[model samples]
Target: MNNTIKILLAEDEPSLGQIVKESLETRNFEVFHVENGEEAYKIYKEEQPAILVLDVMMPKKDGFTLAKEIREENSTIPIIFLTAKSQTKDVLEGFSHGGNDYLKKPFSMEELIVRIHSLLNRVEKIKDVEKIKIGNYTFNYKKQTLELDNISNLLTHREAELLYNLWQQKNEVLDRTFILKKLWGNDDFFNARSMDVFISKLRKKLKKDENIQIVNIRGFGYKLMC
Candidate 1:
């Protein structure tokens, strides 16, 4: 693991937050600790962290709200929720708001470290894949450009993100509703039409590559077959 991985920890409990913050710092993590959700969001913008650990039931904003607000800006930054509320609904709410992992309170330091490492490993893997090769084309995901026949075609932000989403689940059916919600933030009629337009645009862009096809799975979603 690289040294100085940043973590933004939001917990109202001084004892628990300090302990967690100091423990992470011991392992070379740069932690920005805040007592409330409002402050946490402020620090998050100032210092973008590799991961965020948010405790539910904070003063003012609350952890779930914080995660939702952050997700509006960044869809990929990993978030782990620390909450004593272990009900099914609570867990689902956390995930719906863009949390990647959830941990019940009273967790051990060792367990917390393991969860952090696990999430970070997944993030690192995604980060490693800056570019992906499709038949007769090279997609520079980081730069949102598709290169073919020595010509580079720049894609819009939505097009690039949608392509990346499909590519991540290559060869398998990528759910239509999931993609709609993920990329467009809603699966309503207008957004669905917008998604269809984008899909048509992608198909046209990749038409030159005979071996690559973005197949539409009827009533389900689209699949990237290569």
Candidate 2:
């Protein structure tokens, strides 16, 4: 197996693309740089890059649309958009289309490197739990969304983390102290109360699937019954 991290960079500007590609190569990353999103997607399908850094404006296809297409097939891959536009709506659009991070134009190579590593770290944690089946719903840990009947319920960061923990020990008791320390850093009264609220919200979301249940093990913790 090739453990070396691969990066797919799609930037129409030849100079900037070469610079980024060389910078990543100098750091030992295998890079496949393309000038258009269509070729980028082709390389992505064949190469299976660990991370994607794409320009928002491309000739064949735009980054947002490319990302949406990629997300439909592979939701776990990390994507970073390179955009000159700093408009709020433009940034929101990138995210709405499934972008993990965005970099404004004229960004430093160092900043890009950091963003890549940060997103990669997060993906590594949830890679094993991607597309997990929970009764009638499909849990996307990387996207932090639960899908049922083609509708996806976006989850807050804490909610996703909590749900991931619960699913790890499905149908078995997961200690409250372990969850609090891992998630909230401590099991204080305030944090415990907040966890309860999240539990209630998760219960409501999963209620649509009659066969699935999150049972409370009094004096202990919770059990996910699917």
Please give, for residues 1-226, the per-residue lDDT of candidate 1 as tens digits.
6669999999999999999999999998999999999999999999999999999999999999999898778766878899998765676567667776677888999878987887688567665456789878899875668999889987654577789999989999999999876654458775577678778989999999888999989999999998
How do the residues 1-226 of candidate 2 rate in per-residue lDDT, one tens digit apiece?
7566999999999999999999998887999999998999999999999999999999999998899899788767888999998665676567667776677899999989988887788677665554989999999877789999999988654567788899999999999988976654468675577678779989998999899999889889999999
Highest TM-score against the true fold, candidate = 2
Q: How close is candidate 2 to the true structure, as a TM-score?
A: 0.64
Give lDDT per model, in order: 0.84, 0.84
Reference-based lDDT, residue 196, model 2: 81
**Backbone clash count, each prediction separately:** 0, 0
- Model 1 ranges off by over 4 Å: 127-226
Clashing pairs for model 2 are: none
**Regions of candidate 2 where Cα sits further than 4 Å from its true position:** 1-3, 127-144, 147-226
lDDT of 1 at 161: 71
User: What is the Cα-based lDDT of residue 71 in candidate 2?
Assistant: 79
